[model samples]
Structure formats: C-alpha cells, structure tokens
Target: MIKTTVIALLTAASLAGVAAPAYASAFGDVSPEFRSFVADSIVADLNQKGVHATSVEEWGDLIRAYVTNDNGTQTMEFFTPGSLQPVTK
Candidate 1:
C-alpha cells in the first residue's frame, strides 16, 4: 500500500510539472503579439531609466524583463508585452 501510494504521488507530481508549461503557454497566447510589444516597451523604458536590460523572458502568463541599474538588478513585470503597461496593483 505504501509503495503504491508513493508511486501514485510521484506520477501525479511529474504530470503536474509537465502540464505546467502547457498551461502557461495557453495563457500566454492570450496576446503573443501584445506580449512581445510590451516586452520591447519595457526594454525601452528601462533604458530611459538609465538601466541596461539584458533580455525579456516569458514564463506562463507573466513577462519578466531583467535590467541592470546603477543601484542593482531589477525585474519588471507586464501582463502583455504590447501594452507595456505595468501590472496594476
């Protein structure tokens, strides 16, 4: 019984891990063009802010732009890339 339970749990966990990317892709597809646009905006904004942005990475429904500022490193999040609108509080 214990072995079976462990196996089942492991299988479920593995499945969940695999499904996570798919789920994220589906949600991210809401606005692929928008997301890309937003990401570009973010980079521009960061540059104006005197920050050097390395790249923009999309994970699931979130777009994270990494920047290196004079103070330190920072990450900006946007719902869609095209809008470049900051996620509302």
Candidate 2:
C-alpha cells in the first residue's frame, strides 16, 4: 500500500509538469533543430549556472540572449551558438 501511494504521487507530479502553462520565449526565426538545441543545450545550462534564462534570438551565426534583471534597466546579450559566453562588440 505504501509503495503504491508513492508511485501515485510521483505520477501526479510528472503529469503536472507536462500540464504546465506555456509562456513567451525570446528566440526568433529558429529552425526545428535549433529549438531542441536551445532547450537541451542552452536553457538548461544557463539556468543551472544561476542565469535567469529568458530568450534566445538567432540570426545566422549570431545569437542574441535576453536575461531579465531585478533593476529597471533592461539589457540584451549576444553570443555565438556554440559559445556559451556572451560576445561584446
């Protein structure tokens, strides 16, 4: 009985995650391949490193990253797809 209860709770939690609402994403003009790439490679890594991962915009080799901050000032970061570090002009 105890084992069955644990499994039921776990199943409900899994379903809850799948039923979560969708929010706006930052990327644009991305291919299907790139979409999975961003979710698996980019978003997961960024959030793990304490960066409030928001959106990724791609243009050829140039990728734009937007990270929300607490202050009023807004900023956008740039980078190459393979390079996780932000690029500066």
Candidate 3:
C-alpha cells in the first residue's frame, strides 16, 4: 500500500509539472530583421571602438554583443535593436 501511495504521488507530481504553463519570451514584439540590424550596428560600433568581437546574440527584446578588447577582456552590452531614431536617456 505504501509503494502504491508513493507511485501515485510521483505520478501526480509529474502530471502537475507537465500541466504548468510554458514560459513565453518577452522578445515576441521585435522582428527578426530589426534584430539583425541592431546586432550589425553594435558590431560595427565595437569595431570602431577597437574592440574585437567574436559573437553577438539576441535575447528577447535586447541584443547582447560580446567584444574582446586589446587587453583580452570580454564585455557585453544590452541594447534595444531597432532602426528608430536614438532616444536620450
């Protein structure tokens, strides 16, 4: 009886886990083209700054570009990738 109870509890837990809501990413609003443009611009800016970049990634509504400076230190920035005119903070 104890074994059956434990199995039932485990099955219930598994089912509950499966029924949990799937996470939706916040980046659903931005288009792929815009993201690409933003990433490209960031890479260009980094290059201008004399930073050697190896990769860039788009996460949700932000673009993270990784750059390696001459000193061999890696850095990243989160920017909203878009063609819209830049806004002042």
Candidate 4:
C-alpha cells in the first residue's frame, strides 16, 4: 500500500509539471506583431523615463523587461499585459 501510494503521488506530480505550461498557455499567446509592438513600446517608454530598459518580451501572462541600471548591473521587471503597469510582489 505504501509503495503504491508513493508511485501514484509521483505520477500525479509528473503530470502536473507537464500540464503547467499548457495551462499557462491557455491564457492566450499573442501574435508576433503584437509582441513586437509591446516590446518596442515598453522599451521606448521606460527609456524615456530613465529606467534604461534594454528589451522586453512576453512571459506567460505578463511582460518581462530587461533593464540595465546606472550602477552597471541588470535586473528584470515584470509588467501587466495590456496596461503595462509594473507588477508588485
């Protein structure tokens, strides 16, 4: 009984891992053109604000921006999909 439970638990965990990406993708993947537009707009806007944003890309249901700081270090910032507002933890 113990062995069977362990195997079942392991199988369930494996399946969950496999399904996670598909579940996230069900949120909808934007087209290449839309992604490019978002990236370009974010880069321009952030740079204008002096954030030194290097690039941006779609990350699951959010947008991830690569930023370089004045101290010569890099960091990642996440934003909402449509509104482009920063996501707070």
Best by lDDT: 4
Every candidate's lDDT: 0.54, 0.54, 0.50, 0.65
For model 4, where is the 10-residue window of minimal lDDT? 19-28
Which residue pairs collide in model 2, if any? 27-56
Q: Over 4 Å off in model 4, which ranges?
A: 1-34
Q: Give per-model TM-scores.
A: 0.36, 0.48, 0.38, 0.55
- Candidate 1's clash total is 6
lDDT of 2 by residue, 59-82 (tens): 456656677777744467665554
Of 1 and 2, the candidate ranking higher by TM-score:
2
Give candidate 3 misplaced runs (Cα > 4 Å): 1-42, 49-51, 83-89
lDDT of 4 by residue, 1-89 (tens): 99999977875574345423432432245667644544565576567667788997767777688989889999999876545578999
Error of model 3, residue 15, in angstroms:
49
**Candidate 1 stretches greater than 4 Å from native:** 1-51, 74-79
* Tens-digit lDDT string for candidate 3 (2-87): 99999778755643453221112212345687545434545554455555656667565554567676788887655444421122
Estimate, for each residue in 8-65, the C-alpha lDDT of model 1 and write its tens digit: 7875575345433433442345467655544554455455655577667675555566
- Of 2 and 4, the candidate ranking higher by TM-score: 4
> What is the model-wide C-alpha lDDT for candidate 4?
0.65
